[model samples]
Target: MDGITGETDSLGVHLHYDLGNGDRLQLLRLATVAPDQPLAALVPLDGDGLDRLEAIDRLLRTLLGRKIPQDTRLTPQQRRRSRHMLQAIDGRMNGASYRDIATALFGADRVNDHPWKTSPLRDITMDLVKDAFAMIAGGYRTLLRRRHRGS
Candidate 1:
């Protein structure tokens, strides 16, 4: 009998089974199995008229062929943006006005010509401040937790 092996990784899961009489099967989880599918209903003792090994192999092939779920973690750029937003929040807490923070971060030109209430730069800066405060309140913990889980 040939040796059989199975492996799972970020891409998906794979299984290989060898029957002693030169037959072999390879199964890959590329998609989820449907509840009403024949393979989903397979059991060890209920092979119908097919060979037990063959039935098992078919069932495994169908069941295992599913794509691995994609990771939804933040990208490096997003993390950097979060850090910058936190810095803006810190600036606000330290007595800097919205215009001051905007000038400091985005340069004087972006803040000098526009009225405070209507300035796009001010709006963006305020949004960052809000996001930063949200992070401080609890959202930052999610990042820390993800880091620990990933490690």
Candidate 2:
């Protein structure tokens, strides 16, 4: 979303999905974490398997109120929100803190010039923001891989 992060990291990517059901899914795609990695290897800090990807996908579809081919929905309103949110997110693409992102999206007033608080105007939840970024990063990585293979 931020022009600052016009590209993915050298090693991995991140994705965020906001299902309409009020459930948000955040996925971090490591540089080496291919989509087909054995499920056993996706353990979190507590060694728990990341089994929420499907649930996240389902939630995101529900949020869209319809099934769409791409990760993002196509309705006018949703598209508008996505565009604004993406742009705000992009402004912070260069590894900004969560508070900084909230401020950029919600503005300084909603954020009250504070550094640690969240901005009220922020529509997308924090988790969804995280997931969206992961997805974008992953897409970039996949693109690079394909380009390399073609070359």
Candidate 3:
């Protein structure tokens, strides 16, 4: 027999199952559990045998398919920020000036300040643009490879 424990938090659900024979499984940020799904079917109530192993395999597949919730993965504000950064990077690639990108994103008054090079807002914007460009170049590919390796 296996004992199951679960809890929910801001990220999502965390689950741990201990199979009596020393095998254990831990799952984090499981998006959701369908109310009508036969969760109990994955646990053998009678005996621990080949049937339980098969059940575990099926459960793993089903849970992996669900994926982590979007909010748990990235907040709405973060998503918007990333989108803006990508737009700024695209504008730069198209030969738009930093001031022009700033004006388009934050308005003329915010970007028209003298000594723009020393401006905090301008510096932050430039940093974001640089990061976006790096991501487009090779950082994104590295991230994807890391994700696959981790999985």
Candidate 4:
């Protein structure tokens, strides 16, 4: 394991496994294992347990050089919205008005098609900006784990 290292302490061992392409896994080992034994995950049975397990599975797939399923990944539409959210947030920080941001995002034609005061794009742009601000303020951590249907 060229890229694997661990530190032992009173609490436990903290293992840092780094991959070639810049990805890294920070695993905590609760107990010592034999040299030839495989590592295992200790997941808590709780509301977010499934999401945590899925994240571990994804990490294992990456380490094993296997393909992670696309469905478990963010969809194209979701990715686009994330990109737009970041863009809108950046525009606002750069002193661009909501109308200007909307024009850049949805284009001048779509933004100009409706009255500025009542344009749907205005609302969309505002929501994106608001959501992005929340994300910047630590809400992005919530997006890391998949939520339950009603969660």
TM-score of each: 0.45, 0.32, 0.45, 0.77
Superior candidate under lDDT, 2 versus 3: 3
TM-score of 1: 0.45
TM-score of 2: 0.32
Tell me how candidate 4 scores on lDDT.
0.85
User: Candidates' lDDT values, in order?
Assistant: 0.67, 0.50, 0.65, 0.85
Ten residues in sequence with the least summed lDDT for candidate 2? 142-151
lDDT of 4 by residue, 47-117 (tens): 78898889888878876879986544466787788899999999999999999999999999999999999
Q: Which candidate is the best by TM-score?
A: 4
Q: List the residue pairs that clash in candidate 1.
A: 29-64, 29-65, 29-66, 30-65, 30-66, 30-67, 31-65, 31-66
Best by lDDT: 4
Write the residue-wise lDDT of candidate 3 on 42-144 in tens digits: 4546534344555455565545554432223345775677787888998898999887888888888877775688777688679779989888877764332
Candidate 3 overall lDDT versus native: 0.65
Is candidate 1 or 4 superior in TM-score? 4
CA RMSD, predictions in order: 16.4, 17.4, 15.6, 2.9
Instruction: Give one digit per residue, the lDDT tens place, for model 1 in 15-129.
Output: 5766446876665553364324332333455423234444455445544664434333567788778877977998999999988888888899878788878999998999999
**What is the Cα-based lDDT of residue 96 in candidate 1?**
94
